[model samples]
Target: PPATARPAPAPAARLAGIWQQLAAQNTEIADLTAIKNHFERVLAGRTWGDPVLLHGDLTLRNVLVQADGGVAVLDTDLALTGPAAYDLGFLDASLDFIDRWQVLSRGRLYDDAGLGLARMALRDGYDAGGAADDVALCRALRLLQRAAELGEHVQRTRPALARVLIPRLIHPYFLAAAARALGVG
Candidate 1:
Protein backbone atom coordinates (compact mmCIF):
# COMPACT_ATOMS: atom_id res chain seq x y z
CA PRO A 1 0.00 0.00 0.00
CA PRO A 2 1.17 3.51 -0.73
CA ALA A 3 1.46 5.93 2.11
CA THR A 4 0.70 9.62 2.10
CA ALA A 5 2.54 12.07 4.31
CA ARG A 6 0.57 14.48 6.41
CA PRO A 7 1.75 18.04 6.51
CA ALA A 8 3.65 18.95 9.62
CA PRO A 9 1.83 21.35 11.86
CA ALA A 10 3.18 24.81 12.54
CA PRO A 11 5.47 25.22 15.56
CA ALA A 12 2.75 26.90 17.61
CA ALA A 13 0.40 24.01 17.00
CA ARG A 14 3.07 21.53 17.98
CA LEU A 15 3.62 23.43 21.22
CA ALA A 16 -0.10 23.57 21.80
CA GLY A 17 -0.22 19.83 21.52
CA ILE A 18 2.34 19.56 24.29
CA TRP A 19 0.28 21.86 26.44
CA GLN A 20 -2.81 19.81 25.76
CA GLN A 21 -1.01 16.68 26.79
CA LEU A 22 -0.01 18.26 30.05
CA ALA A 23 -3.54 19.43 30.72
CA ALA A 24 -5.11 16.11 29.81
CA GLN A 25 -2.89 14.19 32.16
CA ASN A 26 -3.28 16.74 34.97
CA THR A 27 0.49 16.86 35.11
CA GLU A 28 0.83 20.60 35.22
CA ILE A 29 2.60 20.85 38.55
CA ALA A 30 4.16 24.14 39.59
CA ASP A 31 7.60 23.30 38.29
CA LEU A 32 6.35 21.98 34.98
CA THR A 33 3.89 24.83 34.61
CA ALA A 34 6.64 27.34 35.23
CA ILE A 35 8.82 25.66 32.68
CA LYS A 36 6.02 25.64 30.15
CA ASN A 37 5.34 29.32 30.71
CA HIS A 38 9.00 30.13 30.36
CA PHE A 39 9.23 28.04 27.24
CA GLU A 40 6.37 29.98 25.75
CA ARG A 41 8.00 33.24 26.78
CA VAL A 42 11.24 32.19 25.12
CA LEU A 43 9.42 31.27 21.94
CA ALA A 44 7.58 34.55 21.98
CA GLY A 45 10.79 36.52 22.47
CA ARG A 46 12.51 35.04 19.41
CA THR A 47 12.06 36.27 15.87
CA TRP A 48 11.56 33.26 13.63
CA GLY A 49 12.27 33.07 9.93
CA ASP A 50 10.24 31.22 7.36
CA PRO A 51 10.07 27.57 8.27
CA VAL A 52 12.53 25.36 6.45
CA LEU A 53 13.25 21.64 6.25
CA LEU A 54 14.46 20.39 9.61
CA HIS A 55 15.63 17.02 10.81
CA GLY A 56 13.20 16.62 13.68
CA ASP A 57 15.18 13.81 15.23
CA LEU A 58 18.76 14.84 14.68
CA THR A 59 20.55 12.45 17.00
CA LEU A 60 23.78 10.49 16.84
CA ARG A 61 21.91 7.33 15.97
CA ASN A 62 20.59 8.98 12.83
CA VAL A 63 24.08 9.83 11.62
CA LEU A 64 25.87 7.25 9.50
CA VAL A 65 29.57 6.60 9.14
CA GLN A 66 29.98 6.37 5.43
CA ALA A 67 32.42 3.92 3.86
CA ASP A 68 34.35 6.72 2.18
CA GLY A 69 35.20 8.22 5.58
CA GLY A 70 32.55 10.86 5.23
CA VAL A 71 29.21 11.10 7.01
CA ALA A 72 25.59 10.57 6.10
CA VAL A 73 22.21 11.03 7.76
CA LEU A 74 19.46 8.46 8.16
CA ASP A 75 15.93 8.08 9.49
CA THR A 76 14.74 11.29 7.94
CA ASP A 77 11.11 10.23 8.04
CA LEU A 78 10.59 12.73 10.85
CA ALA A 79 11.92 15.61 8.80
CA LEU A 80 9.64 18.62 8.45
CA THR A 81 9.58 22.37 8.06
CA GLY A 82 10.58 24.40 11.11
CA PRO A 83 13.09 26.92 12.40
CA ALA A 84 16.68 26.31 11.26
CA ALA A 85 17.93 25.87 14.81
CA TYR A 86 15.38 23.15 15.43
CA ASP A 87 17.82 20.57 14.13
CA LEU A 88 20.91 22.33 15.39
CA GLY A 89 19.47 22.61 18.87
CA PHE A 90 18.47 18.96 18.66
CA LEU A 91 22.13 18.09 18.16
CA ASP A 92 22.90 20.17 21.23
CA ALA A 93 20.10 18.58 23.21
CA SER A 94 21.22 15.10 22.29
CA LEU A 95 24.85 15.73 23.12
CA ASP A 96 24.56 13.83 26.37
CA PHE A 97 23.59 10.71 24.45
CA ILE A 98 25.94 11.01 21.49
CA ASP A 99 28.67 8.67 22.64
CA ARG A 100 30.55 9.10 19.40
CA TRP A 101 30.57 11.21 16.26
CA GLN A 102 32.67 9.08 13.88
CA VAL A 103 36.20 7.81 13.30
CA LEU A 104 37.95 11.12 12.81
CA SER A 105 35.42 13.08 14.81
CA ARG A 106 34.98 10.73 17.74
CA GLY A 107 37.25 11.83 20.56
CA ARG A 108 35.08 13.90 22.92
CA LEU A 109 32.33 15.57 20.99
CA TYR A 110 29.89 14.20 23.53
CA ASP A 111 31.59 15.68 26.54
CA ASP A 112 30.13 18.88 28.01
CA ALA A 113 33.22 21.01 27.28
CA GLY A 114 33.61 19.50 23.85
CA LEU A 115 29.96 20.08 23.03
CA GLY A 116 30.24 23.74 24.08
CA LEU A 117 33.25 24.20 21.83
CA ALA A 118 31.50 22.43 18.99
CA ARG A 119 28.51 24.71 19.40
CA MET A 120 30.71 27.81 19.20
CA ALA A 121 32.44 26.45 16.11
CA LEU A 122 29.15 25.70 14.45
CA ARG A 123 27.74 29.13 15.27
CA ASP A 124 30.88 30.75 13.85
CA GLY A 125 30.92 28.62 10.73
CA TYR A 126 27.27 29.13 9.97
CA ASP A 127 27.31 32.77 11.10
CA ALA A 128 24.17 31.93 13.00
CA GLY A 129 24.70 34.23 15.97
CA GLY A 130 21.12 35.40 15.87
CA ALA A 131 19.90 31.84 16.11
CA ALA A 132 20.95 31.48 19.74
CA ASP A 133 17.49 32.26 21.08
CA ASP A 134 15.97 29.95 18.50
CA VAL A 135 18.29 27.20 19.60
CA ALA A 136 17.27 27.78 23.21
CA LEU A 137 13.61 27.65 22.25
CA CYS A 138 14.18 24.42 20.37
CA ARG A 139 15.98 22.91 23.31
CA ALA A 140 13.08 23.81 25.58
CA LEU A 141 10.69 22.35 23.05
CA ARG A 142 12.63 19.09 23.05
CA LEU A 143 12.48 18.86 26.83
CA LEU A 144 8.78 19.59 26.87
CA GLN A 145 8.22 16.95 24.22
CA ARG A 146 10.03 14.36 26.27
CA ALA A 147 8.15 15.25 29.40
CA ALA A 148 4.82 15.15 27.64
CA GLU A 149 5.54 11.73 26.17
CA LEU A 150 6.63 10.40 29.50
CA GLY A 151 3.54 11.87 31.11
CA GLU A 152 1.34 10.01 28.63
CA HIS A 153 3.12 6.73 29.22
CA VAL A 154 2.88 7.10 32.94
CA GLN A 155 -0.78 8.02 32.86
CA ARG A 156 -1.73 5.18 30.56
CA THR A 157 0.56 2.48 31.89
CA ARG A 158 1.47 3.16 35.50
CA PRO A 159 -0.41 5.77 37.43
CA ALA A 160 1.09 4.79 40.77
CA LEU A 161 4.60 4.81 39.43
CA ALA A 162 3.98 8.08 37.70
CA ARG A 163 3.07 9.74 40.97
CA VAL A 164 6.58 9.10 42.14
CA LEU A 165 8.49 9.42 38.87
CA ILE A 166 6.83 12.37 37.23
CA PRO A 167 7.16 14.94 39.98
CA ARG A 168 10.38 13.77 41.55
CA LEU A 169 12.28 12.74 38.47
CA ILE A 170 10.87 13.55 35.05
CA HIS A 171 9.26 16.91 35.74
CA PRO A 172 12.21 18.17 37.71
CA TYR A 173 14.64 17.30 34.98
CA PHE A 174 12.54 18.91 32.28
CA LEU A 175 12.03 22.01 34.40
CA ALA A 176 15.72 22.36 35.09
CA ALA A 177 16.66 21.86 31.47
CA ALA A 178 14.04 24.30 30.32
CA ALA A 179 15.18 26.80 32.88
CA ARG A 180 18.75 26.49 31.66
CA ALA A 181 17.55 26.99 28.11
CA LEU A 182 15.85 30.20 29.17
CA GLY A 183 19.05 31.34 30.87
CA VAL A 184 17.29 31.45 34.21
CA GLY A 185 18.81 28.44 35.87
Candidate 2:
Protein backbone atom coordinates (compact mmCIF):
# COMPACT_ATOMS: atom_id res chain seq x y z
CA PRO A 1 0.00 0.00 0.00
CA PRO A 2 1.59 3.24 -1.15
CA ALA A 3 0.79 6.61 0.36
CA THR A 4 0.36 7.97 -3.14
CA ALA A 5 -2.69 5.82 -3.76
CA ARG A 6 -5.88 7.86 -3.64
CA PRO A 7 -9.27 6.81 -2.44
CA ALA A 8 -11.74 5.71 -5.08
CA PRO A 9 -15.52 5.92 -5.10
CA ALA A 10 -17.63 2.82 -4.80
CA PRO A 11 -17.86 0.72 -7.94
CA ALA A 12 -21.50 1.53 -8.68
CA ALA A 13 -20.96 5.21 -8.09
CA ARG A 14 -17.94 5.20 -10.37
CA LEU A 15 -19.92 3.63 -13.20
CA ALA A 16 -22.98 5.85 -12.91
CA GLY A 17 -21.77 8.88 -14.81
CA ILE A 18 -20.00 6.87 -17.50
CA TRP A 19 -23.09 4.78 -17.95
CA GLN A 20 -25.17 7.90 -18.41
CA GLN A 21 -22.84 9.17 -21.10
CA LEU A 22 -22.73 5.86 -22.89
CA ALA A 23 -26.46 5.28 -22.78
CA ALA A 24 -27.05 8.77 -24.13
CA GLN A 25 -24.86 8.11 -27.14
CA ASN A 26 -26.27 4.71 -28.07
CA THR A 27 -29.79 3.77 -27.24
CA GLU A 28 -29.10 0.13 -28.02
CA ILE A 29 -26.90 -0.11 -24.98
CA ALA A 30 -29.63 1.20 -22.73
CA ASP A 31 -30.85 -2.33 -22.23
CA LEU A 32 -27.77 -2.88 -20.14
CA THR A 33 -29.40 -0.90 -17.35
CA ALA A 34 -30.76 -4.10 -15.87
CA ILE A 35 -27.30 -5.53 -15.65
CA LYS A 36 -26.01 -2.35 -14.13
CA ASN A 37 -28.75 -2.41 -11.55
CA HIS A 38 -27.87 -5.96 -10.69
CA PHE A 39 -24.28 -4.96 -10.10
CA GLU A 40 -25.44 -2.16 -7.78
CA ARG A 41 -27.56 -4.50 -5.77
CA VAL A 42 -24.88 -7.14 -5.42
CA LEU A 43 -22.25 -4.66 -4.42
CA ALA A 44 -24.60 -3.01 -1.98
CA GLY A 45 -24.92 -6.27 -0.09
CA ARG A 46 -21.26 -7.15 0.10
CA THR A 47 -18.69 -5.98 2.61
CA TRP A 48 -15.48 -4.89 0.96
CA GLY A 49 -12.57 -5.45 3.29
CA ASP A 50 -10.55 -2.55 4.65
CA PRO A 51 -9.16 -0.20 2.07
CA VAL A 52 -5.55 -0.86 1.12
CA LEU A 53 -3.13 0.82 -1.23
CA LEU A 54 -3.53 -0.48 -4.81
CA HIS A 55 -1.75 0.06 -8.09
CA GLY A 56 -5.16 1.19 -9.45
CA ASP A 57 -4.30 0.13 -12.98
CA LEU A 58 -2.90 -3.39 -12.88
CA THR A 59 -2.55 -4.54 -16.47
CA LEU A 60 0.05 -6.85 -18.02
CA ARG A 61 1.78 -3.87 -19.60
CA ASN A 62 2.42 -2.37 -16.17
CA VAL A 63 4.21 -5.41 -14.78
CA LEU A 64 7.90 -6.30 -15.26
CA VAL A 65 9.96 -9.36 -14.47
CA GLN A 66 13.43 -8.70 -13.13
CA ALA A 67 16.48 -10.77 -14.06
CA ASP A 68 16.83 -11.92 -10.48
CA GLY A 69 13.31 -13.41 -10.49
CA GLY A 70 11.68 -10.45 -8.84
CA VAL A 71 8.57 -8.67 -10.03
CA ALA A 72 7.95 -4.95 -10.32
CA VAL A 73 4.90 -2.80 -11.00
CA LEU A 74 4.78 0.35 -13.07
CA ASP A 75 2.34 3.25 -13.44
CA THR A 76 1.07 4.45 -10.09
CA ASP A 77 -0.83 7.33 -11.65
CA LEU A 78 -4.14 5.53 -11.16
CA ALA A 79 -3.16 4.20 -7.74
CA LEU A 80 -6.02 4.17 -5.24
CA THR A 81 -6.99 2.76 -1.89
CA GLY A 82 -9.70 0.10 -2.01
CA PRO A 83 -10.31 -3.57 -1.51
CA ALA A 84 -7.44 -5.86 -2.52
CA ALA A 85 -9.89 -7.57 -4.84
CA TYR A 86 -10.01 -4.46 -7.03
CA ASP A 87 -6.46 -4.94 -8.28
CA LEU A 88 -6.95 -8.66 -8.82
CA GLY A 89 -10.19 -8.13 -10.71
CA PHE A 90 -8.76 -5.26 -12.74
CA LEU A 91 -5.85 -7.41 -13.89
CA ASP A 92 -8.11 -10.32 -14.77
CA ALA A 93 -10.51 -8.16 -16.74
CA SER A 94 -7.62 -6.47 -18.54
CA LEU A 95 -6.22 -9.79 -19.70
CA ASP A 96 -9.65 -10.86 -20.87
CA PHE A 97 -10.07 -7.62 -22.79
CA ILE A 98 -6.69 -7.98 -24.51
CA ASP A 99 -7.52 -11.49 -25.68
CA ARG A 100 -10.89 -10.43 -27.06
CA TRP A 101 -9.58 -7.20 -28.55
CA GLN A 102 -7.02 -9.14 -30.56
CA VAL A 103 -9.74 -11.34 -31.99
CA LEU A 104 -11.98 -8.38 -32.80
CA SER A 105 -9.37 -6.03 -34.23
CA ARG A 106 -6.79 -8.37 -35.82
CA GLY A 107 -8.76 -11.56 -36.43
CA ARG A 108 -6.17 -13.41 -34.36
CA LEU A 109 -7.31 -16.39 -32.38
CA TYR A 110 -5.63 -17.38 -29.12
CA ASP A 111 -5.86 -20.59 -27.18
CA ASP A 112 -8.55 -20.47 -24.53
CA ALA A 113 -6.71 -23.11 -22.52
CA GLY A 114 -3.72 -20.83 -22.13
CA LEU A 115 -5.86 -17.94 -20.98
CA GLY A 116 -7.65 -20.21 -18.51
CA LEU A 117 -4.35 -21.35 -17.07
CA ALA A 118 -3.18 -17.79 -16.67
CA ARG A 119 -6.35 -16.80 -14.86
CA MET A 120 -5.96 -19.82 -12.56
CA ALA A 121 -2.41 -18.85 -11.81
CA LEU A 122 -3.50 -15.33 -10.95
CA ARG A 123 -6.11 -16.56 -8.52
CA ASP A 124 -3.78 -19.13 -6.98
CA GLY A 125 -0.99 -16.65 -6.51
CA TYR A 126 -3.15 -14.06 -4.74
CA ASP A 127 -4.12 -14.64 -1.16
CA ALA A 128 -7.70 -13.47 -1.63
CA GLY A 129 -8.83 -15.57 1.31
CA GLY A 130 -12.65 -15.51 1.50
CA ALA A 131 -13.10 -12.57 -0.86
CA ALA A 132 -13.43 -14.74 -3.98
CA ASP A 133 -16.96 -13.51 -4.62
CA ASP A 134 -15.82 -9.93 -4.21
CA VAL A 135 -13.15 -10.53 -6.81
CA ALA A 136 -15.69 -11.82 -9.30
CA LEU A 137 -18.01 -8.90 -8.60
CA CYS A 138 -15.20 -6.42 -9.12
CA ARG A 139 -14.20 -8.17 -12.34
CA ALA A 140 -17.74 -7.86 -13.68
CA LEU A 141 -17.93 -4.21 -12.69
CA ARG A 142 -14.58 -3.45 -14.31
CA LEU A 143 -15.66 -5.09 -17.54
CA LEU A 144 -18.76 -2.96 -17.71
CA GLN A 145 -16.75 0.14 -16.86
CA ARG A 146 -14.32 -0.65 -19.67
CA ALA A 147 -17.20 -1.08 -22.08
CA ALA A 148 -18.70 2.25 -21.09
CA GLU A 149 -15.36 3.98 -21.45
CA LEU A 150 -14.86 2.49 -24.91
CA GLY A 151 -18.27 3.59 -26.00
CA GLU A 152 -17.65 7.10 -24.79
CA HIS A 153 -14.26 7.17 -26.49
CA VAL A 154 -15.66 6.02 -29.80
CA GLN A 155 -18.40 8.61 -29.63
CA ARG A 156 -15.84 11.32 -29.04
CA THR A 157 -13.17 10.29 -31.54
CA ARG A 158 -14.83 8.44 -34.41
CA PRO A 159 -16.64 9.99 -37.28
CA ALA A 160 -20.44 9.98 -37.27
CA LEU A 161 -20.48 7.23 -39.89
CA ALA A 162 -18.00 5.01 -38.09
CA ARG A 163 -18.83 5.78 -34.48
CA VAL A 164 -21.51 3.16 -34.13
CA LEU A 165 -19.64 0.09 -35.25
CA ILE A 166 -17.11 -0.49 -32.49
CA PRO A 167 -19.45 0.09 -29.60
CA ARG A 168 -22.25 -1.96 -31.13
CA LEU A 169 -19.90 -4.84 -31.75
CA ILE A 170 -17.95 -4.90 -28.51
CA HIS A 171 -20.22 -3.39 -25.90
CA PRO A 172 -22.52 -6.37 -25.85
CA TYR A 173 -19.55 -8.70 -25.77
CA PHE A 174 -18.29 -6.97 -22.65
CA LEU A 175 -21.76 -6.98 -21.15
CA ALA A 176 -22.26 -10.68 -21.75
CA ALA A 177 -18.84 -11.45 -20.38
CA ALA A 178 -19.57 -9.29 -17.38
CA ALA A 179 -22.79 -11.15 -16.80
CA ARG A 180 -20.94 -14.43 -16.93
CA ALA A 181 -18.42 -13.16 -14.45
CA LEU A 182 -21.31 -12.22 -12.19
CA GLY A 183 -22.69 -15.77 -12.44
CA VAL A 184 -25.73 -14.47 -14.30
CA GLY A 185 -26.93 -15.53 -17.74
Overall local distance difference test of candidate 2: 0.68
RMSD of each: 5.7, 4.1
Per-residue lDDT over 48-95 for candidate 2, one digit per residue giving the tens place of the 0 to 100 score:
776776778887667654434345679878878877788788877877
Colliding pairs, model 1: none
Off by over 4 Å in 1: 1-8, 65-70, 97-133
Q: Candidate 1, residues 1-185: lDDT per residue as tens digits?
A: 01333344655777899888867766756766667666667557556775555556877666544333344568978876656677777776666422234312646424444445555554553344344447766767777777788878887899878778877777677767767776764
Off by over 4 Å in 2: 1-4, 29-31, 66-69, 99-132
Q: Candidate 2: minimum summed lDDT over ten consecutive residues — where?
A: 102-111
Cα error of candidate 1 at position 38, Å: 2.5
